[model samples]
Target: MSATTLLLVTLGLALASFAYGRSRAYSVARLGGGVRSMHSLPSHYGMMVALWCALPALAIIVGWKLFEPSVVSGFLQDYIPQSVYEAGEKSVELYKNDIGNLVDSQAIADIQDPDKKIAAQQLASMRHISSLALFVLALAAAIAGATLALKRIKADTRARHNVEKIVQFFLISCASIAILTTLGIVLSVLFESLRFFQEVSIIEFITGTTWSPQTAIRADQVGSSGSFGAVPLFLGTMLISFIAMVVAVPFGLMSAIYLAEYASRPVRSICKPLLEILAGIPTVVYGFFAALTVAPALRSFGATLGLSVSSESALAAGAVMGIMIIPFVSSLSDDVITAVPQSMRDGSYGLGATKSETIRKVVIPAALPGIVGGVLLAVSRAIGETMIVVMAAGLAANLTANPLEAVTTVTVQIVTLLTGDQEFDSAKTLAAFALGLMLFVVTLCLNVIALHVVRKYREQYE
Candidate 1:
């Protein structure tokens, strides 16, 4: 049997076990006069039985999967010719790979080499044996566990307690997995960035004004030494992000405030979802709009004003990016603003304050923390954005504050560097990791500042 088929059979058994467990609990309760005499609910007893039935079988399946490959490989090694082994481990590995592929493709009959055909046949036989063994073992384990749990389903059994403990352990395991996964990602990025820094000076990467990352493969080639300066990337990222924030924050916040405080219920209902529809539009579409429409419009307008504007300028990208993020800010801010206690607004009104005054002094203060969080999220979204920038803002690492000029962001360059076949050992490829590390640091700092602001305001509001 296949693993998936076996898994379905196990689950089918568990379902049957649940019904039997519940019936057993009812029978035990009848012996004690009524279900009220039981120590736990019938559902809890059923859940306990289901857990017992599935857990042991699942454990066996997991352990089998982990060890099956190595065990099969070890058994297959005996079939390899002595000459192939003497050729070295690499040659033996290649021979094994060939046999495995033949088995997978079911092409062992087509093989001309007698030894390889025999090896492939053996591999197929072993895989069949392994699957059959697993199916039998898992079913046996499930039946045995369910029978044991069903026998113990007495009126006085603490089935609820056991089920709760199992659930708690599962939740804790999930939390630990998430934390460990994050730690692993950070460590991997840090190690790769360290390798990159070994090749290029960290100071030069951070502070140098030029941002060329092209290193020639040959020593005698022109421009063989590449500049790893990241200042231009940093400035471009900040300039575009700043422009986006300027466009998003005011418009989004004002729209949120009007929706939460001033608009009638009908108007708010109609407008809110319409406003949020902006978020549903894909970023690539926004990129197209910026590149094909907004950028050209800006260029024409600039020409009328006797000013030079690049066809792909940061302003066009930033403006479209801002429009894309408006819904994020508006939706979040609206929720928070609406969540502010009505009693606070009533108190402000009792003090003879107008609606606008009460909103400005009382409602907005209470909602400021959430608004700040929303803005921070939008800013991070802007910084990490790639498609919109790539399509609208041309990839020129120019160190200029002018939004009218073409520029590139750290994310764009990182994507550019890692797009094709790259040697990880080279500084050019490793630079992507270094850039990723810097982006992580920047985002972490933003989170810290947002937290500080949130905590300070939250204390007063609370």
Candidate 2:
């Protein structure tokens, strides 16, 4: 049987076990006059039996599923011809894939080779038997666990405690998975970056102004020697992000304040959702809007003002990016502002302070931490955005502080490095991971700051 079929059967048994366990507990309780004779409720006893019946069977089935492919592949070794089996690892992998294809697409009538046809048939028979054995084992485990649990159920049984322990274990497992996944990502990026640093000088990568990443095919090859300077990319990223923040923070924060503090309930209900709808629109659409609409409009506006702005400028991208991140800031800041105690506002009013003065002094200070956290989150969103930047900001790695100049960001460079039919062994490819590591560190710092702000302020208020 397949894993799906086996799991369904096990679930059915667990349901049956739950009902039987509950009935048995109720019968035992009746013998002692009432349910007060039992240590826990009949429902608790039922849940305990269900947990035992499901957990062991689920664990066995999951273990079988995890190792099934490898075990079947190991079995296929006996059927491999000596000539193909003696080949290198790549050949062996190819041979294994061919076996899977043959099983899927070729029947006894379709196979021209008599040996392969016989081997495929044998492989099919073995897998079927293995699946059947797994199904039987899972069902047996479920039955045994349910029987043991039901037999243990009595007046003195701590069914609630056992259930709590199982649930606690599950929660711990989920947390561990998230933590281990993050650790794995950090280590992988570190290893790849270390490989990159071995090929290029870390000092040159960080300090040099030029950003060409080409590596020569041969030592004597002309025009292939590349500069690995990341200064321009970093500067460009900072410039664009600065512009985005300048646009986003003021507008978003002001909008949040207005919506939360001043606006009528009906207006708040209608406008807030409408404003947040900007966040739901795809970034690709924003990219199109930035490229076709915003960039051209900016260029034309600059011309009317007798100012020079590139066709694809940082200002255009940043402005569009800021608009994209508005909901992130406004939505979060609005929540934080609304969460401020109404009593504080009332107290301010009693002190002869106007509504604006109360908001500026008491309410804002009270909610500063959460608002700061929200802005930090918006900053992160702006930094991580790719499509809008790619479309509005042209891919010229110019080292400029001017918002009117076209510049490419670190994200754009990373994308450039990874895309296309390129060899992974070169410094060009490895540089992407190194950039990734740098980006990870920057984002990590932002997260740390946001946490610190929230924690420090939260302590004072709570």
Candidate 3:
């Protein structure tokens, strides 16, 4: 059958299952109508049956789709003519492509020989038959399962509880998909990094002072051994992050404090969202702003003070990133501070403490863990930020503490390494993975520590 037919059949079965389950649930409840009724409403029973019917069958269909192509291709290769089968790998690949095109187009013009045209038609027919068989089997299983569930519905059935548990499981599965995707990405990076390590020593990549990634394009080309020292890039990232934090934290914290503790409801209603507008601004916009405005301003200001400042400097990028993160720090810290019980503030006020004193001595300490958590989260964001650094901070990795000089970062290096046409197996490409792994590990560790601190502080408060 066609895909459209299969879809329509599945949809029909699902609707039928829902109606059947609902009828059965109502029937059971009506039998016990005088006093004791069903554990759940009829609609809940219907939903439960619908989910049971659709979920497993859908899962099977998805699994089949994932592996069916490879299985079918392997089987079809055996049916090819011996002459075509004995061809080189490239020729075999070309023949497979031709067959696929013929199957898709459903036309016989490309196959010049009558025998080959007949064989192609036969193979295409077999493929369609296999697909139809799978679809029918899946549909039957779904309908059967749903029918059984409807039969099982009775007055004493815990359909509501079962349905709720299934919903919770589905939600957890959705969350796990995101986590699994991250793990997949990390593993891919690690495997490629391992390949790179085989060609270049870890010692050289990590400890070398130079930072050139450009290498000879051919075997006879000159200046081929590119340096991969990561120290300067790391320093640049740190420097920029520090600058951004310095810019954002004080203003963000002050705004949070005012909003949470001092500001009236009316003022806060307006100011809070206004402050968040900074966070909403696109990072790419911030990038160009840093490059065009902030960098030039800094250069002119430095010249006045007899200081040499590069137009594209870590200071400019870092400052912009800090401004970008201010909202993150302020909003989170404000919420945590606000969450501290009102009784704590009241007791401090009773002790003759001023508003500022109560806030500093009682409120801040009580909310310290949450505030720290927010700060740590912001720090992680700063470390991984790419756009501002890519635009404002120059690519030359200079291992210097001077923020005035141009600097590169781990993220910038990764971008540069992976950009353009390059071999994946090369050490340069793999370096990006190693850098990514390090960045991931650092952020992961920080998040863990922050969680632990927050949990411990919550226990103390309780």
lDDT of model 2, residue 80: 72
TM-score of each: 0.95, 0.95, 0.87
> Global CA lDDT of candidate 3, please?
0.84
lDDT comparing candidate 2 with the true structure:
0.89
lDDT of 1 at 375: 91
lDDT of each candidate versus the true structure: 0.92, 0.89, 0.84
- Pull out the clashing pairs in model 2: none
Once superposed on the true structure, which residue ranges of model 1 sit more than 4 Å away at CA?
A: 82-88, 217-223
* Model 2 collision count: 0
Model 1, span 297-342: residue lDDT tens: 9999999999999999999999999999999899989998999989
Model 2, range 1-462, lDDT digits (tens) per residue?
A: 777888889989999999999999999899987999999999889999999999999998999889988998888888877777678778878877776787767554687776677677777877888898898888889999999999988998999899889999999999999999999999999999999999899999999999989886555667567888999999989888888999899989999999999999999999999999999999999999999999999999999999998999999999999998899999999999999989899999999999999999998999999999989988878777788889999889998999998998889888988898877778889999999899889888998999999998876755
Shift in Å, residue 425, candidate 3: 2.8
Of models 1 and 3, which has the larger TM-score?
1
Report residue 322 deviation for candidate 1 (angstroms). 0.6
Where is the poorest 10-residue window by lDDT in model 3?
A: 30-39
lDDT-wise, the better of 2 and 3 is 2
